[model samples]
Target: MSNPNSLVEGWARRYGRLEARPSNVNPLDEFSGLSRRLRGLRLKEWIGFTLLHPDWYSSLIIQDAHYLASSEIYAYDRAAAALHQHAVTMRSGSMPMPSALFGHRYTAHRGDYSIEYEFDDTDGRHVLAIDIAETATAPAISGELHLDAAHAGRPLSVSSRLPGRRSRMYTHKAIFPAGGVLRVGDREIVYRPERDLAILDEHRSLLPYRTTWLWGTFAMRAEGGVVGANFVDRPEITGEAEESCVWTPTACEPLDDVVFEPAEPADPDAPWRMHSADGRLEVEFTPEGRKEVKRQLGLFAIDYFQMFGTYRGVVRGAEGSYEVQGVHGVCESMRARL
Candidate 1:
């Protein structure tokens, strides 16, 4: 077994920071150091795409989104695969989200069904759009979603190095009002800026061959205000401060490490409890639906499970305390051998 304290210290020496920075910094440029400065070292690059709403959550993920992982790139529609279309509804007793392994494609640059990022001194934004004709498992789906810092406020970003590997993790989370329309055949779910909230979970990393982590994020209306949070626990995250924080309309409050208690048997429908050591955050997650994918290919495999659900809790910040009730979000557990 590894000494947890020693692992954390090692990470802090390489990646820990004392403060937060704005999200406008280009992640591609930040992570380019090792690859650019050194030769014959391995690097993995990709952008995850996600769109969240009160009624549902949709994702069109393009791993190796930029074809930076290697000289050759792949795009396929398959469970536990890198590129695919997925969606989950939030209704009570709702069925699992529809996932189809088709209409998967990849581009090296920003274009239709591609992930795009732009940032400058004045603003920053990341956009993802996809259009899939009707498939065997679901209806036609199309939509465009972007996270705009000019409108949503600055995001929280973290950049760190992986232990014992010539790799790094650069990630950012932006929570803001999202406006778009996801048309599922004839049923259109419009995301109005006045009512809907969205979060952007952008990550690019070159991880070890085997990795495991626990992550959860929530965004919703609480006590007449908007609240959003991102929390994670992984062995590679050795920094003194984990990538955890709570975002309000006006400010982002950095938080200490969080503790998660998954129900025994790890049932998807069971209530998962989470809280912070300082007593600043506490919540009970009741899952409505889940997306589970398991893939095994000789030496490489990925077992990923994400639970979409509603949260009820209390969050204390510099401004005050906010009560969160029936707010929709996601919690995930992943074990992977890359």
Candidate 2:
């Protein structure tokens, strides 16, 4: 492992840069059929205290999922899992988070469900749309939104008061749409990732950093099948560096040696549906949509701090077929000059 912290930082800087991509530059993604490698890259082990509420399984909220984990990529996993725990553990608090306050929110509604997609108004500070997916009850709601990250860390700012919202906030919070189905085995629990998040930074040319870390949920089914599904990243593969991670949980262990190759969006006017390939595990993912979280780098655009989407891919195996679903991610912004 090269473990080049400086190199990784340099690429991070490039990812934020805005420039026209060189004609000869090719992305080494799953669709590209290029194998990515990782030696020593950026910070690896993410240490954080995490939490999850048991009611998450019964909730119809997208944030209320069966698994809660704290990952190192950017500590988003920890933030998410901790919020869940807070929602369940301390339903009412002086200062509270939404997920914690509504650990069992899914139990409140019931109905048949559907998926909706729409883009809200855009601002230089805030750029993104929301993907709303609903399901039958014990109902639950899953809405994916790319809120403003441009000013996420900015100093105190007045937020637009969302209309028709009555929940009081000791502290302000951002939430996507709510309502979806709660599965029978949905358990609200937080954990350290079962598998160490993999980094392809050192080995993969597709990645920009001297190294990058991939974090995701890796699990197995009751039928003795393995399941490894999590988003991966190849920051700085192209100027607007791309990031992606895919898995099959039905296996004994998370699939390894995955790749990302992309094709222009269906309409050639839509987002690209990149293929996440892992031949050794016979798993691949076709992205369904993209959610832009952040777009920066002066007007030319150098950095992209964003998220995208993925769909369950049909895994071809010697014995039979397997279904992988609920995939999402982002590499929003071209010539990411970060």
Candidate 3:
């Protein structure tokens, strides 16, 4: 197992300039294998949908759910293990447009669970609806989350070609003040309009057989305004182009590489320290809860751990410095063979 952080230094110098992509650009339009000559090898695409609240975090994922691949639909409560459920479905063939992982209108149904994801406007506002019936492993959960992103403004998007492969990775992240209503069995949870926040993570990539990455993100209310951060260390990217940023209400500031160090690897609730090389961002994350998933099936396997906690430290932005204490969010480390 090699360290992924070692692959990010001098990334821009070796790979050239990493540009800021437009928020309105459709990722499917930039497929590297669009030409007729390279269509045979274009086989991977996926989307990860997430909703965050102060008390809990919910995720609905449709990975390769539209094409000739083994698509998976899973929903989980980040704070509780009793609310996790998943199902796998196999598609017969492949199609180009209106893809469940990329297009504006996407929906999929498997067993008694169904999910729909849509991009509503150019400003990164979207909707995600998930309905799950009671299963043997979890209770019934249903919600229609409306992410009105007027406050978080524009998104931070980046695209890059994977080295030594005919593939590209495009990622878009936007954080906004969110409000919705959820029903879990007989209990109802209401997310007030001005009291909650959510993050939209849209990832479309053509990846290799073996992939590994470390990712961390969070959004919370500050004294004056809102704050958000996205950090990643992966083999497909490096240098100034790495998807790292500190987001404010007015602007998004690109950050240098970040390093994640855990106080103890065996402890899921261990404190983790995160810092940037340029001294612009620093924080200590103390985990309050965690969600762990492990799946192994011969040639394909995934091991993922996500910790929810509060950030206590300071972050310097363009306007001024802001102190963060007891701000809620999540941090994760993942290794996958896809």
Candidate 4:
């Protein structure tokens, strides 16, 4: 599906800009010896995951970022207004790159967090197991989520080379049915396939020195079926690969650039409005709470905010229009110099 000598870029237009499930393409083979260069030190990779239930919000994020291994866990109970957050950072090697190609197995250990993702060919699903050992400072969080990829449709997988630099990036986004029992402290949050969903955002990119982007995603029931979306706005995306799309029960509908308008520029908990440039999508997000991170370590700096919220919107596609009513999801704004 790609030329050997050329950097893999863009999805096939005929395929709705969606690649086949379980892609075999590996970016490492193309990145090769570039990881040792000064420019390559800016490369960033991470896996951001979200599990959605009706009344609960949970996220486990692992980053082999720039030159540090970092992980975070955030869980919130909307009814009780309870929030649990823990983050740890350590100097370590980069995350396993082959996991993006085939997803055989990979693990990241940071402080008390141990996160693992393994693919089981027998059942054609990816199992995500997260174990956070209880310490004097925090409680334990353990869960094993089974992401049913065998039945999920194709994913939005795209690759592109930067315009004026040697930087390149590969990103994969998929929404699939998932069920699990996540225990946080003494409370148990259960997810059933019939009513819950999961969204996986995986990225392995050789980024520039400074990068910024606005990203939003959600999965929920709408119009008698399930519909999910991934909207992103990045200036470096030279149109060779537009990684924005709406995932329906049948196909992934490709979308043009999306605009994010915040009611209050600096407030992460404010209501945000989003619309597609072509007028095919419009949504309003009202955030309940946010996990905000701002830190500066010498030459490295990061200001990131990811807000958990509910979305109300309309998405017009070839099949029909999907209306989402107060569905749970997340939106993020990030600016980093790594």
**TM-score per candidate:** 0.72, 0.28, 0.79, 0.89
**Which candidate has the top score in TM-score?**
4
For residues 74-175, could you state the per-residue lDDT of candidate 1 as single tens digits?
122222222324332122112111111112223323222223233233445444455655556555666665445466734665666666555566565667
lDDT of 4 at 170: 69
Sort the predicted structures by lDDT, highest score first. Answer: 4, 3, 1, 2
* Per-candidate count of clashing residue pairs (backbone under 3 Å): 0, 74, 1, 0
Candidate 2 stretches greater than 4 Å from native:
1-226, 231-257, 265-278, 281-289, 294-302, 305-310, 315-321, 325-338
TM-score of 2: 0.28
Candidate order, TM-score descending: 4, 3, 1, 2
Global CA lDDT computed for model 4: 0.75
RMSD of each: 10.2, 19.6, 6.7, 3.5
Task: Score candidate 3 by lDDT.
Answer: 0.62
Once superposed on the true structure, which residue ranges of model 3 sit more than 4 Å away at CA? 1-44, 65-83, 86-89, 92-103, 122-125, 223-225, 236-240
TM-score winner between candidates 2 and 4 = 4
- How many Å off is the CA of 117 in candidate 1? 7.0
Cα distance off (Å), candidate 3, residue 5 = 33
- TM accuracy, model 3: 0.79
Reference-based lDDT, each prediction? 0.56, 0.24, 0.62, 0.75
Report how far off residue 336 is in candidate 1 (Å). Answer: 0.4
| Candidate 4 error regions (>4 Å) | 2-18, 21-28, 31-39, 99-103, 222-225
Q: Give candidate 1 regions above 4 Å deviation.
A: 1-42, 65-127, 146-148, 222-225, 236-239
**For residues 1-338, what per-residue lDDT tens digits would candidate 3 score against the true structure?**
12112212332211222333333333344333445224333445555544566666555555561234433333334445434445545562332223232227566666777767776656556676777787776667778777775566456666566643555565667776777787766656677657777776766555555777777777777655577677776675444266778877666787787888888978877898888887777888887766676878676777987766677887778897778787777788778666
